[model samples]
Target chain A: MSDSRVSSVIQEWASPFPGQAHTMHPVTSGQAESTGQLAQMEMMPYGQSQLMMREGGEDRVAEQMMGMSYLSYSSSCIGNAPSAASTNHHHQSHGNNEQDFSHFLLPTLRAPLTKRSLSKDSAEYRLRRERNNVAVRKSRDKARRRIQLTQQRAMQLQEENQKLQMRIGQLTQELDTLKHILSQRHMPGSEEGAAGESRI
Target chain B: MSDSRVSSVIQEWASPFPGQAHTMHPVTSGQAESTGQLAQMEMMPYGQSQLMMREGGEDRVAEQMMGMSYLSYSSSCIGNAPSAASTNHHHQSHGNNEQDFSHFLLPTLRAPLTKRSLSKDSAEYRLRRERNNVAVRKSRDKARRRIQLTQQRAMQLQEENQKLQMRIGQLTQELDTLKHILSQRHMPGSEEGAAGESRI
Candidate 1:
């Protein structure tokens, strides 16, 4: 947008996030219109977590992060049914890394999915299943809120950012006006007027 | 709101934007949690803006930021019938700043609200009014998009903040686990067992 209000938004973002000044190598400025376009492109989400909102917000991010971190862990156990074979294979594949994050992950992942086995339908298993479901829901809700908090956090940062930018703009205008006034005062005719006044 | 998801939304806000790491002068962290809560109160407009959305991603944020900024500026000027008296008062109120950002704002503000006086009913006046109406729509749309961009910028920031926190959480967990493992190994006999073979 060529409008001033729109242009300001574009400019604020085209500049670096606060305190990242050292990282933001300054480039030549564009015409106001193009600058706005530049900011829109740069800030657009390239492929940010497509958290299926229908599913949930933070939970999806957690799921994705968890899935990626433990892909080998989840995938390996997917068919192996948490048997000793899968655990052995998991350790074997990860022989060098001392991480057993998967070791903790495997039992938790396998438990809730509970393998549609006949034994899973038993009252004891159902009760256990209910408890697990409740826990999962609780964790998911926590995750969702966490995600929301982070989002709010993001908002505060931006507000602070906008406020700072506004301050910068105001200062720049003030400086410009002061410079203009000083220049006018020193103009040749103005200098003569001042000298005449002093003589009087 | 106490649902884990909502509480997290609240908590995330309650905490300070990360990297104020100095004042986080760690006074047992609960008070900070409440502080984060106060921030949440400020940032809830931000969260409501979040809309638990999983679809069409970041474009939405750009859309929102553009919307809000324009809303305030636009709503303020709406329907007051930009009269000569109001314009005179506006200038007089602005007294000798040697700046007239409002000079730029005036024509754009008035054209759409063409006064209903018989003088404006002339064909030339009607034609001018039509052109002004189109320009007004264009400017409004641009203003709307600019506001959306600011809001989106806020949203993106929150997302980044969340991601950073998640990484911190993961790293802390890893550190704790390593400490536990190291404690176990140094428990005296565990070292030989670890050294004898890579049996682990």
Candidate 2:
């Protein structure tokens, strides 16, 4: 149940195959509640052709990420609140030139940046963050489920394969026994002779 | 492959499962050559329990993303160049109050903003973006390969299952035939006589 134990298991389960060098960055922002972020990032590398354990570790990681997101979101909002002058500066700096638009003739319908800062402090930014967070969570859960299903399917198939091999051996042995009996009944110069031969 | 055809296939391959309402946002920034960004974004939704064709379409999409990154890097650099005054403003605006650091006493080592703006125009920003683009590409390709391998494994298992079932049927038939022959030899009043009954 401890974070360290879960984190270590996750690290092993998700280590990249040799030579790939797929470095999964842990969530390193020093927040005590940020245990889940590392797991989320770590899981990204499990898409490699390695067999990862989807047992209890993934469930714990998922919970951790869910808890971490709330804290991270709140902290980010506090740190990134834009001031009035900074918002004004951002608006004045982004200018429009029709000449720059000539190359890509799409409709320029977005209103000027002055009307809304779209800063971390803004309502729009928070809304977008909320939506993105939900999307990311959904995506992660779907991925975990897929991996679990694949593992189950693989195990089922392997069992089936073994059963098939055993059945093939059984059939071969029975066929041999039947052929031997027929041969015994139809011996070249035995007591049952021609009658048994006709039957065979 | 034309962009439209690939896009249609991708859209079908990655449509969210019923009731999930997972709306995947396409790359809407209209630049004519920005074909790959949509595919990249679309692939994220494929982690759901659906069979996606990692055929010609994926290869095209990967190429498109690689191509698009160069253009995006170039365009973003041009648009986000920081001004001298803005750099100064950013430095002055970000204050260092020791009180704010009391809650989380980590080393605050990043220098003043004026030392390096880290804007889209900055070399540091470009380097980071370049690294991120490569990491994303690697991650995407690995995911695609995993999906393909899963599909292949599933098919192989199904085929093996069928073969095993056929073998089981064949063995059952052979066992039945041998039993019938033995029964005929040991009948109550068969012409084979008491000698056959002794052998049985």
Candidate 3:
């Protein structure tokens, strides 16, 4: 469990491998593989993902990167806020069909909440707090990574853009030189324009 | 409240102005201004934000885009899991200082939760569910917009790349024609070699 947690932290932070700093870092092989896959998955470039989306004949890569599982609300709740409210009211009246309810429902109902024990001292509150703490961390980490990855991808594209522009400039200069040589040689009255020499 | 909600929804989704779709849309002037600001804020390109980050001597743009407010956990809870656990234990001892506590604590502990109404039928549960529903929508919309923005950036860069490549090709072909003309004209023995017309 501890190794998995460490591995997940590395993946979430996208931190450089700690093994580089500490040569003897004790990581299980499974932990290493999982972390490696997550890093690879996130580090995939935006252009490459678009290509993959086209090649696969679907947007699975884009969907996966968007964290589809976390965002997958029922279609009923997606765009229609009015419908979502009505759905909530529907559940309020027919509470028996609670299994289909979303994150709004408590995950486990081992025991009902009691006002007397609702104080922070109670075990239930502690359990709930612990669970929420984990959730908050997960959500925050996910958002932070998304922002970081977007920035990284943007930087990559910017560098590529610069390189392509430079290439165009170089080609343009070369073409200009070639055209200057041709103009010098093809001057009808200046047949002896220094044979093959052009200032350009 | 409803107008604010709709304006916020527009900002979160970064959807095109609805006024474009409904000519008679009833948007208050203030709502229109707020939505316009948010749209402008989010539509700022990644490169422009990076430049702003540099000029401002801070990463305010990046921080804002990352939704720093939502993710700002106390330092105690951020990275040090063990410290976070201990912090929770400390909170358990000092329940009086609940304000410093994060989302784990109920936002408003009205009369305390009692076991009887802990079921879904309670007004407390309904209120909590509604608040959570709003939060869920806000978080999902923010994430979806982030993904869309990143993809939009990638597409922009890809198109730029293609244009640059095409320019290079044109330059290269032009250069080749120039060189062919120069060679044809500079041929010492071929003085009448189509002086200005080399089939190029």
Best by lDDT: 2
Which pairs clash in the backbone of model 3?
A113-B115, A114-B114, A114-B115, A115-B113, A115-B114, A115-B115
Ranking by DockQ: 2, 3, 1
Question: Candidates' lDDT values, in order?
Answer: 0.31, 0.36, 0.35
Worst 10 residues of 3 chain B by lDDT: B59-68
Q: How many clashes in each structure?
A: 27, 0, 6
Per-residue lDDT over B1-200 for candidate 2, one digit per residue giving the tens place of the 0 to 100 score:
11111112122212234232222222221121111111122222345533333222111100010011001111111122121112222212233321232334333443222233343333444455445654664465556555555556766897888878876876676666666666676566663521221111
Summarize candidate 1's per-residue lDDT along B1-66 as a digit string, tens digits. Answer: 111111111222223342222222111111212122212232233223322212211111111110
Compare candidates 1 and 3 on TM-score and give the better one.
Answer: 3
Q: What ranking emerges by TM-score with the best candidate at the front?
A: 2, 3, 1
Each model's DockQ score: 0.02, 0.08, 0.06
Per-residue error (Å), model 3, residue B124: 21
The local lDDT score (0 to 100) that residue A192 gets in candidate 2 is 51
Candidate 3 lDDT over B1-106, as tens digits, reads 1111111112221233423322221221112211111112233343322211111111111100000111112222111111111121111123233242233557
lDDT by residue (tens digit), candidate 2, A16-134:
23233222222221121111111122233245433333222111100000011011111111121111112222212223321233334434443232233334333444455456654
Model 1 chain B, poorest ten-residue lDDT window?
Answer: B62-71
Report per-prediction Cα RMSD to one decimal: 31.9, 19.8, 22.3
